[model samples]
Target: MDKFLLQQQVLDRLAEDLLQVEQALREAHETATHEENIAENKYDTLGLEAAYLATGQARRAEAIRQAMAHWRQFRPRPYDASQGIQLGALVCLVDAGGQQQHLFLGPDGGSMRLLSGTQLVQVISSEAPLGRAMLGKYEGDGVLIGVGSIRQQFEVLQVD
Candidate 1:
């Protein structure tokens, strides 16, 4: 699998998301300027609530833009599993159920699974729980990641 291509695919997916988010932010911000957004009474907080929602949406859109910028500047290096997991490393793991997964340790993109030709690439941020557990791990190692009270076993097959 080509890591660089996978990276680009992830970025493309995030870029698509950014577009939708920006459009949503525009709609949210537009609400504040509309006359109907005005509160009916002092106790009615419709206008104030619209302003808050628009502000939050703007921040969210900005964050996604920053993540895209970060991804654009990143250069993926060849991985040596002995060095442990790091950003830009493509990792392969098998779960206790015998299911195999291909994961990319990325700097910012999270919860995005992309289909890169025949390979399925999952982009994860280092701050995420599963991403954190995968970091600093070598091939042939075992990891137990907990989702709530259940701990799932995973075997590190390789890192590319």
Candidate 2:
């Protein structure tokens, strides 16, 4: 598949997911409010129930909001030399030991699946180690992760 087309598809999917998340959040908030009103007269379980529902809904809503923001920023654009390793780049990398890996930058919807020999590396979001390293970097640039004992290196082979 063409890289641009793939990126756009992923972006569209993320947008749709964001919409769903928003709708879910709204429903959750509404349910929590209704529960709060019902439990208002019953002080015994009111605190516990309201706390549980509110906390869960708030956490999920925050997570989805953060993901939506990240995906919005990573939306694809026309690749220019000046852009370096912006979002939507199909990055090819080789580890120091010569193992190859591929990363398709996109949202965190459990959608990244790339083949490395017989192994598959699942890319999640741009906030991950390798993803962060690749961001704003040009071809031939090297990123070092960790130090000494757990040290690893990745060399950017190509960006598209």
Candidate 3:
């Protein structure tokens, strides 16, 4: 799969999410400032509630903007066995059941799943549990992650 193209796809999806957030922010702001929403008494918190919603929406919009900036600057490099798995490595892992999963390790705030052709790829950050376990691991290496009380195991089938 083309990593560059996958990056573009991620950007496109983020752009859509940003647009929705911006629209929600605008509506929230309007509701907060509308004359009808103004509090008539201490118990009437419509205006205050709307203001809080607007603030949250504004913060969400800002976060999306920052995520976009980070993704724009990200570059996925070619995989090297000697270097082991790092950010931008496209990895395929197999579980004990023989089920395979594909992942594209990337920058933070871009943890999402997308379909690249017929294959589904999960984009993760190095900070994630599984991502941290895969770091510096080579092909045929074993990766173990604990979720609650259960421990899941996977083998590094391939890295590209």
Please give the CA lDDT of all the candidate structures: 0.83, 0.66, 0.93
TM-scores vs. true structure, each candidate: 0.89, 0.55, 0.97
Number of backbone clashes in candidate 1: 0
lDDT of 3 by residue, 40-73 (tens): 8899888788889989998988988898898999
Clash-forming residue pairs, model 1: none
Q: Across residues 17-100, which tens digit of lDDT does each residue of candidate 1 receive?
A: 888888887887788768987888899777687788889888888888888888899898999656798888888999988899
lDDT of 2 by residue, 1-160 (tens): 2554554455565566667756765665566566445554555565455547667756765765676566556656655668788656677789988988777766665365644445554445576766777788888999777745798889988876
Ranking by lDDT: 3, 1, 2
Comparing 1 and 2 by TM-score, which wins?
1
**Which segments of model 2 are wrong by more than 4 Å?**
1-54, 69-74, 106-126, 147-149
Q: Which pairs of residues clash in candidate 3, taking residues 3 or more apart in a chain or in different chains?
A: none
Off by over 4 Å in 3: none
